[model samples]
Target: MKNFIHTFHKKLQLLAAILILSGVLVSFTYEINTSPDPKKDKVLVGVLRYILKNGHYEPKDVNDDFSKAVYTKFIDEMDPVKRYFIKSDIEEFSQYKYKIDDQLKREDLSFYNLVMERFYQRLEESSTYYKEILAQPFDFEKKEQIKMNYDELDFAKNKNELIDSWRKQMKFNVLNRIQVQLEIEEDKVKEDSTYVKRDFATIEIEAREKTLENINDFYERITELDHTDWFSTFVNCMVEQFDPHTTYFAPRIKEQFDINISGKIEGIGARLQEKNDYTKIVELISGGPAWKQGDLEVGDIILKVAQKDEEPVDIVGMRLDDAIKLIKGKKGTEVILTVKKVDNSIQKITIVRDVVELEETFVKSSIAIKDGKKYGIINLPKFYIDFENPDGRNSGSDMEKEIEALKKENIEGLLIDLRNNGGGSLKTAIEIGGLFIDKGPIVQVKYRGNSPSVKKDTDSDMQWDGSLVILVNELSASASEILAAAMQDYKRAVIIGSNQTYGKGTVQNVIPLNKYYNYPDDLGAVKLTIQKFYRINGGSTQLEGVHSDIAMPDKYSYVEIGERDLKNPLAWDKIEKANYEEMDFYKNFDQVVNTSKERISNSEEFTKINEYAIWLKQAQENNSFSLNFEKYIEEEKEHQAEIDRFKDVFKHESNLEFQSPLKELDLVKKDSSLAAKREAWHKNLKKDIYIDEALKVLSELEPKNNKLLAKK
Candidate 1:
């Protein structure tokens, strides 16, 4: 056994060396590019065709260079700085035409080497920057920090120490990855022992030896090697070749997407992410099991999770999915998590598993007042609501209720706040849009089908006939676009905020891999684009998202942060317009628009927005980024100073907090004034900015009409 172990170790070393050598060669050989290369195009097409055919999809024409074109287009859209590759890079990449099989054979080794080099580079860079960043007092004002840690170890501040740390970190990462892959593979083997028939004795012996060798190599490298900085260089080189979205999803990275999307999952109802070696709770969902227990809080690091009557399993450096699987069990099961609090105190807390739901993301309502006029505000955190489960509280229903409430209050206008709404259900969107207008077309959707289908506002009645406004930003997407487009087309509401919508009009269907392959049913699901949606007015909310009527300034102005900015995104096109009529009340839109422009131009808020827009534009143009510690600190301070300028002017309070608009209406004396107030309140109830201006215009028009009536 000892001899065999020695031999295995020797083989692994050889394999590792071969991988590193191949990766170095490949890195130097391939140059990233955008222009057409027939050879590269052919290779891309072949790979895509294979994926399509073998990957459970109908094979399209693989002969064409469509895949390469799509990839190039996608990359061009995503790279804000355009630093990944230049035209020269494309020209260089066009020279290579390697076979897929040959690439696959050395792919693992190449990837490992590339990653190792990248890791080392980042370690050195981070270490140098860390020392500089720590020299200054921590900037407490900025919400985010670029660097998390710094060290000033006098005795161990040498190249060896840095190398050792880097190696240790890499080994930890590699082991975690191997463990996760093994577990997934093992599950597959157990489900169908026939295909994965393993000789247990041989497997056990081989695995034990490999594990020991991995540990030994990791330890030896950390203690012995003179580490070189290579992370940034390697990552840039690799990512440049690959499409922007095709990133390395490390074992701990599963939670990153979860953080951005759902915020909370069923397991303990806590948000988790890897910070250094620890899986820390970024947030605890309110009213969840974790919050109910009152033991966990944001920034608490979870070290282990133990099942009832089982030994506590150390989860540090474990794959996020595996850890989550252990933590999350059947509802009603008890699981105890050993947690390290922010202050470094450790404690064990038992939490009962329950259906943990995120309530904070649900639609909320308020009222905004400007120039002594009330505007109903419906703040939708996300375009979300479970459609599969009928019992779920639909966002559409919630929005309808808010509209009704505003109507009851008799608001002068309404604003639908979808600033950070990252989209949810399409069904809910249709239902919500149905609340505004009488029976008409809401949005048209076209699949890879023969014809397009027009989804209409089929609801029996309208909730409010008042003026409407939609407040959107770059994050407003998918279902949010559906509602916004519907209102825009019908002229039921004026769209406000941001340059354009998120442009994610396409729909994706989650395809279960286990279902497709009749093998051991443990493989995960794949989300694939299945359909695209078009506005009632033929134009697609695709690459070019729906443009806003009244654009507002934002920090992300220059960042191109939208679905259209994503890699491999579909193109924008047009379809047949749906049947719909413009609202008669909004006929005098010219006068309203002019009045709004005049009013907003004089307002402090609008001036601030204009200033912010200019700042963002300037920031985008800034290409000289500093990696030097002192320079970075200076830049950060300058950035903060610029941000602070808007702090005073951005203060707009909710009118709902002061007094109900309903109560205020009761104080009006004269019948004509009371009637005018009612009209203004009704328009405000729709949360429409344009409508508010329109109401003011109407107020001015009313006296003239009264005089005309007296003359008659």
Candidate 2:
């Protein structure tokens, strides 16, 4: 009895310790809010938060700043242009400005629900504003301007103020239409003296009708978006605070993302992006309907899309996915796009939708004889791989075969063009890097809570040992940087292009959240940034991609397209340099690089490129546009003249004929797409000044004996 009494105090202390730990654990766990949708979506919020907090490579604390960031991003996603929501609404939402992290920790979405509910109410109010304004015709003779860059403007003060903002915006939209219609009617008058031309009143009426139709489609599209669509915005807003590339893809959206990454789609293959409320073509899928037709071009603003025999639906100010839904359809169906060309001329282009296989994404090569020395140019669009099949066609293997074919042709030098390659499998990157360098470390990867590991090219046999040069652009990313940096580090290849690559070095793994829960339906997936990659020389590419060995002026040299411009991008870092050995680089590497830079400095084309880049930078900076029709027309003509002047600079064609890789002769004969795309590619190469300069650099890289044979 005496011994038991002595230990009673010890037992009491132990009990207190257990209770404190339990309370801490419970406090950190999430709790569901009272809203019906929150009750349903609480699981996603919890899972996404847990993954980001735990698995993310550079996780931020769930603190006041993070909560503030979420609030700001969520509001921006809802209304990017400040046309909706007043300053009062923002202040009201600020109550949860510091409490969002608390709500997230408690698994509550009271703030989200309140803000979104108010957003819908504002949406309803704004819909009336557009309709009321469009009912009356816009006065084109009025001298006014609309701020095209919404980021530079502040939100409205109240509902009436919001209506006035919408009035100006709607007036501007109608003015654009009236001006185009007036130009068309004027052109028709030139064709025939008696051609009955519509008057200004009729033109104005038509513009109003078009504007009303566009707004109607917009409202209808919003109606189609359910809770899932809204929730995606909230979820992504949370994840994106970690990094720009980190994202949360909802179920259907994930399917589309997978299709995009797979490099295949069953629709009219044209990539689109929203810039200043207009959907512009970012690029075209080669061998796809858009590329084959060649009517829709880069920088073309798609104003509307229509099915066969149906009235065109205006896509202006519409969300990207909604416009994509209208444009994408079953294979063999036709979709017509009403596009405003870069010259500000409007036209309709028809592209028959087809199953765009993205054959161009695969490694394609050609034999180019420059200075009489045979050189091989291999264009790798991306580091593509069939993840489902281990032995399937992948960049690494396809590249090996292409190199072998080029070697068989007795090529003396090689140009591995990775320009615009946004990267894929790390395994393929390693394998491809091995082709040039001997067995050595290619890249280093760092994960949270673990020592950085070195990924290597273990192959002892060398593949392409010739003098090499790699082409890159600002669009080149991830695995592309890995290969380029490795080659640069080993001095195995000369890197050229934009000032730097896209600077995306973080690695993401898309984990389907549904896999972690016992829930019945799909819960979508979280693209978690779990690791970062570094060059073998210890430099990370997080925000400073791989710097080019020979920096050249390109379109994006003065543009802010790199990762450093993105929101909350991960910080660049370094680790100990990985073990590697240098390859036998070109003996005259320094001489060649120096000569090339000197030539580019003196060339008229380079001068024009630099001038055009300056003009582009200025144009990007000036976002306010006049609503006056005459002034707008005058501005368009000025821009067209400026763009046309640069045409001659980019128009210098090289007399280089490229042949199919020797091993692909039979395949090229059998595959019409293969033959067609290569022919098209070779034709462009003939017109490529960059490739022409690259060839000249290759000539200088060759030794005297090699140069003499090349000269012959």
Candidate 3:
């Protein structure tokens, strides 16, 4: 069971084809404002309509069904929790539910204007309701419950009903805080017999005050968002019907995307997300200052950020963009963060900002020893490439280099891990796949109304002709899926892990609004899906990602995940197969798969993992909780017990030993941070049951050719 307060941060990385827009220019006028600009909105509608009909891989018909989807999505996006809008409000807005398509065609803003005005009025009124509710103390003795099953809930019938709903939600918040505080007090009393505990009434009042402060902070963030931001949401509701990945980025957001693509920012190199009222650290770029500092970690909450010798700015409920701006600065500068650690302890961490290099995103290799035989394990985080510079570093070259080093180590087999890779450059994927097999068609691409074009790896230099294994999960997508599909088709490698990889076969191109229009102000752009990918063997990975040769039970095994789970994802289809030769290297591939299946089934750890995944899904589906403090605490304790039982899933250690390649070892010595990171990685590898299973499989495989060993 997951806590509502400390949930994991999820990052969405798009796999796109960045192309230059040239040749044609459609004229348009632009306007900018903190409020809604009818002229600008009309222009955006016209441009998006033209692009969707012309450029999108598959465009939905602009009918009543489409209009209804947009209407529902826009309302849900505005008031997700059913807190702001009332039944009457929805009733009044339902008149235009089937007219949005007509309005879009006519460049009309009547429905949009009506909704925006009512939304603003309701938003202001909500502040008063929350303030009034918080001014009075809640009755904890009342035996009541709050149902957070938002989808099943109906809007409030009247103003009185809406106020009561807010009251219950506020009560729930305060109750959770009070329960936590009481637990801390009880723990203190257990440690020290003489420690006097505070009275329940005093603790209850304090919780109310704290909850009020948090609510105010939430409202402060709301105030920062203007009409333009809301309009962007409305636009996205329409665009997302085409596909999940296709989105409308506002001018400010587009600028940030450009900055990220260039990868030249100087910061602490930690990816963060706005988790409710706090900023949560999601990922730390390897070899970065934050990774080196060792104090910051994933799941840590940033409460405040302060520069060197400056007063700390409490960032709770702050806008993510604003929080990021404060965190980022020039290289060599120091930023101090007051963070709430995973253990609930607050501490200040100081990190000197530096250029977060693309070093960590490259390929990393390690040598594993099993039964006196050496094997190579390479972990590729993404299929990265420098788009602006041809000579800059990329994953393909780094992969080839790692393989050559591994070949020198006299490794008998090789394994590549692409577990959570979300994909990047398609060119890099093709190049890397070429290193595994002789020249062949790697993948097929098809644009709208065009025949499938094969993307071939013409190079015939097979880098490692040894036994090969690739590990993937539901998170491995796009370019990662391409390489895995190519290898599986050619029988070059055994794919293992989840049932299927992340099914992201579509290619998107960001079309800038200003590029096609004569606009005075930057009008942002739309990321339009223009192409689809197909395997060399004639299957599309659109929804049915590459099937694994040997499936394994994982934490996400039973969860709704991948492209198939997304709304309005392009359907899976097949095309004509590209001619290719399947390798004749490994012996009894079916027997190998059967052997692994038997082992996985008999293993206690794998059984426990599958059981835990089932239980976690059930827990996620449950959203009701008692407001009564006693029952609430009891429920929390039961959940915590279940969580504790599964802790060993990650804690179990293996006997296999892992070490860095010779060249990386030398580089590690010169960089202490890199050394520490590699040491931690090797330690984790020692505990990896999956890696242990992979090593066993690697040891059993028989290769037809020994060219790599012979060269060594």
Candidate topping lDDT: 3
lDDT of 3 by residue, 304-335 (tens): 89999996776876767778889999999999
Candidate 1 stretches with Cα past 4 Å from truth are: 1-359, 367-375, 388-391, 601-605, 620-649, 652-712
How accurate locally is residue 328 in candidate 2, as Cα lDDT from 0 to 100?
79
Candidate 3 has its poorest 10 consecutive residues by lDDT at: 7-16
- Each model's Cα RMSD: 17.6, 16.7, 10.0
What shift in Å separates residue 599 of candidate 3 from its native position after superposition?
0.5
Query: For candidate 2, what is the TM-score?
Result: 0.88
Candidate 3 TM-score over all chains jointly: 0.87
Best by TM-score: 2
Across 433-495, the per-residue lDDT of candidate 1 in tens digits comes to 988776888888776754788987777687766666777777677888888988887777777
Tell me the deviation in Å of residue 549 in model 2: 1.6
Give lDDT tens digits, candidate 2, residues 390-457: 87899999999988878778887888888767788898999999988668999999999798899988
